[model samples]
Target: MHRTLLWLLATAALAGSAGPPARTAMPAPPPAVGEAARTGGRPWPVPGTPVVVRTWNPPATPYGPGHRGVDLAAPPGTEIRAVAAGRVTFAGPVAGTGVLTITLDGSGSPPLRTTYEPVRALVRVGERVAAGQLVATVETEEAAPAHCKEEGCLHWGLKRGEVYLNPLALVRGGHARLLPVWGV
Candidate 1:
């Protein structure tokens, strides 16, 4: 009983050092449907089918512990497309997860880049792909057991320089709705 009490105290001390988790009241509304096209943006990286996002939390700082991108709910082997016309800059594994990066043309002063991860890349580095073109496929348990078997989702990310942007902002057509998480 004494040892257990000590362990609980130590755990509480470590938890206190970690501080409270960051929370946002809620994000502002997203653009209406077709608003992106009206604004001259390209279609979603994965189109046609409705995208179900499992997670959409970006880190407040570089290398922070928060989720750096949105995880889209997709089955294994689903085709992953390019969100915009760009050249494939990377198509390889990074720290175990398969990552694909595309540098957008005429996107901004510093240029925008998009990244998809835990995918079985089909395109080669330096390959110029058009908007909505297939670049990779979601990984299956046979391909990436760690991520695919755990949860079949595509982690879609966007960045300009070192600043991460919300990838969903590029595709969300309606207002943002916060999904509640209930615990037992």
Candidate 2:
């Protein structure tokens, strides 16, 4: 009886010590090449500028093991523009990193919410901004860790209700579909 009791206590102690699961948010799968066309929207958040996708994993659930957004290879202090007309809803720090959210207007039921992270907000909350209008600037390593090696990156995300939608769909005019290079 004593041995069984000890085993139970050891198991309980180990389980309690385990704590919460570590967050392993993987990058979302590549978006469809060209799904449905965007109803209507502006250009890339950073226009006329070349950008590389650093990370593109969107979490599979509202709180799941997936990247909830895409990280673009952007230099620190790069200007971030609004993808569409909307009013700034949130501009604040999240876990020591700055985050800015804009609730898009006329985006349909629930309204799509766009988020830019590791940014320094240039626009104020509740301020109306037009497509292509500057809203924030990517922060430098001095402010936060350079997420993209020494270059830094901008984490952009889009969500409707609690569902995380690919923000690339907005930039590419639709979903970025995967096309086979050679037919088998």
Candidate 3:
């Protein structure tokens, strides 16, 4: 499902830059400092570089367990946009990836810190997310994670009711941006 989302998003982006319709609700309050990794820096996510996928669905290994995320070959420090509008539930450090995990503030946090930023939740558990909004910063790391295929890329993922979902389709507010939360 996440792979499909990523493809759909890439197609939409190639076809046109106009993203999906904005969700109803005023803009969220400004995020805290350092909450969002800026567009440019040491570890950029993909600010301008074309979006590329490294592992659509990689096999599981020592890093945690099953494949629960998609790795994008983006330049490190790339600005990772939010797939949907939901408060950030967790953001910090994952063991393997050794980066930050910015999970949305959804139903609940399911201890899935497979990367370096094992379990980093930037936004609070009860905040609001805006489509295409800046959710997490491109990893700010001196050295890219071993799991990262590109020299400076990130393994983005999403979830729906505990189900691991794709991260791309939701990029730049693709179909994944239409998700409804809090009865909104």
Model 2 per-residue lDDT at 29: 24
Which 10 consecutive positions of candidate 1 have the poorest summed lDDT?
Answer: 17-26
> TM-score: which candidate is best?
2
At residue 151, candidate 2 shows an lDDT of: 70
RMSD (Å) of each candidate, 1 decimal: 14.4, 15.2, 11.9
Error of 3 at 34 (Å): 23
Q: Which is the better candidate, 1 or 3, if ranked by TM-score? A: 1
> What are the per-residue Cα lDDT tens digits for candidate 1 across 81-159?
7877899999998887788999987665566789997788999999999776789998775444343455576778877
For model 1, the stretches where C-alpha displacement exceeds 4 angstroms are: 1-41, 142-151, 173-184
lDDT against the true structure, each candidate: 0.64, 0.66, 0.42
Candidate 2 residue runs with Cα over 4 Å from true position: 1-41, 142-147, 174-184
lDDT of 3: 0.42
Q: How accurate is candidate 1 locally (lDDT)?
A: 0.64
Error of 2 at 54 (Å): 2.8
Q: Candidate 3: where is the Cα deviation over 4 Å? A: 1-49, 58-66, 96-125, 141-143, 147-150, 171-184
